[model samples]
Target: MRIKNSTVVITGADSGIGRATALRFAKKGARVVLASRDAAALETLAADCRRRGAKALAVQTDVADPEAVEELCESAVGNFGRIDIWVNNAGTGVFGPFLDTPLEDIQRVVDVDLMGVVHGAREALEQMRAQGEGVLINVASMAGIIPQPYTSAYSMSKAAVRALGVSLRSELRLARVKDIHVVTVSPGAVDTPFFDHVANYTGQDTRPIPPTYSPDKIAAAIVNVARSPQRELTVGLIPKAMVAKHKLFPQAVERRMATLTHRKHLKATQPAPPTKGNLDRAAGDDATGRRGRKTGGHGGRTKTMARRLLVIGGAAGVTAFAAFRWRQ
Candidate 1:
């Protein structure tokens, strides 16, 4: 589909992959509608897009609220006349032992991560069906495919999101609706405010796991998927490999991932007090950070750790083939 002059709506436009994606679509000449709980950030991003020579609108929205999401859709149509692409990029996480994490925090994660996507998809599909063509992108995570310890709710929500995509596609196919598409984007640990804003119950500060990719990488994949709709896209090579390995050795991969989550994923040296990190509210603008701060520089040691995990956790014989085939 031609991006130029297309109307695209992106949720979570305040930061991370969503922010990058909004800019990308704008540069491609698409009119962008930005949504987030952070109205100030959304407006700032919208202005940036406008400066890039594309029309932009900012809508303050809480995706967990169905009414608000519906209004977001209405706002898009009211302004642009039609919706060409809708991206459900807003997400939050809760990190800590399952028992230690607050039940309310877990519920909030599911509400924002899983139900948020469902709300967006439902609203976007409504507009798409009427318009006769559109792309609905849901930003899930590798955690959906491979469970990450200390993130039971996050993992469960993401897995549900993946299943939502599959079920939507099946329904679309059975109904012979070919133009409207549902695409799921699963990225590895991305360099985003995700870690910064995640509710952490652990005594240690939380960080992205090793081998994290830039949000731009995921943004690029999102644009590519928009151009040529696919059922799903996983962003990084390591994540793709991990997903494939998980399919073959679920128990082994889960155990290894759990170990990694306990050790490397949390910063033992950096003690942090527990806070309800942006679950009920928005984080400060600085939470997004510059590119350099995003991954906090995983360094050689973490990279080596990632590689070793792959080597030990994957089935030696089929690992390479599975990873290769997954990409194809």
Candidate 2:
């Protein structure tokens, strides 16, 4: 649909990908509603959007609270008449081994990442079904598909997120609601505050894996999808290839991931204490904007240390998978 004068609501709008997506849409003449637990930051972002000539409202909302999310939807419509696009971007993570991670932390991750998407989608779909047209964009991660070993909760949440979109699409089609579109975007490791805010138990400061892409690129893809919605999108090139390889050689890839891929998941930098970073509370004062501080983490290829030996030993196992055959 056309962007100008459209009404859009974005959750988790205070920082990171949500903020970037809000700004991108606002610049296109869309009235934007900002939602997150950080009211101060949302106010700042609303002012920024207003300066860009878009009608803006800041509504502090915690997606985990069903009532708060419903209130968010009412506030958006009360201020702006109708909802044309809803971006379900509010999310948090826990980066630790399952056994070591606290149960509360795991539950919070599900509440924010998976259930949060469910709430946004439900509210948006209700509004959209009434109007007979709307767009819903859910931001899932590459971890959902590839499956990271350490961050089990986050991986499960994201995977369920993908499933949610697929099921929603099927249900909508069955009901003949073709105008309402549900799009799922799977992004690669992104340069966002997520790594900084994740509940870490790995004993070392966590960082996004190598081949990180900017949040702005993701925001752009989301805006594009709003105009021309597709079934699913894998944002970055490296992530696309990774997904392909994993599908072609599941056992081999699982073995590779299980092997010492510490560099792939984290940096050998300073250690951080075990804390529920942003799972329960809003990230304090520093959560106002998109784009996070660059990490000095892995910047090169995730080349195996013993590349020759692994490839040679697994040659027969992977020979059937010609497309995924690894080479030196």
State TM-scores per candidate. 0.91, 0.89
The window of 10 residues in a row where model 2 has the poorest summed lDDT is 295-304
Deviation in Å, model 1, residue 13 alpha carbon: 0.7
Cα lDDT tens digits, model 1, 190-268, are: 7777777778999898877777777777898999899999999987667776776777779998999999988878888
Question: Per-prediction count of colliding residue pairs?
Answer: 0, 0
Cα lDDT for residue 236, model 2?
66
> Each prediction's Cα RMSD?
3.8, 5.1
By lDDT, the best candidate is 1
What does the lDDT read for residue 273 in candidate 1? 96
lDDT of 2 at 252: 80
For model 2 the TM-score comes to 0.89
Model 2: how large is the Cα RMSD against the reference?
A: 5.1
Instruction: Give residue 38's lDDT in candidate 1 (0 to 100).
Output: 87
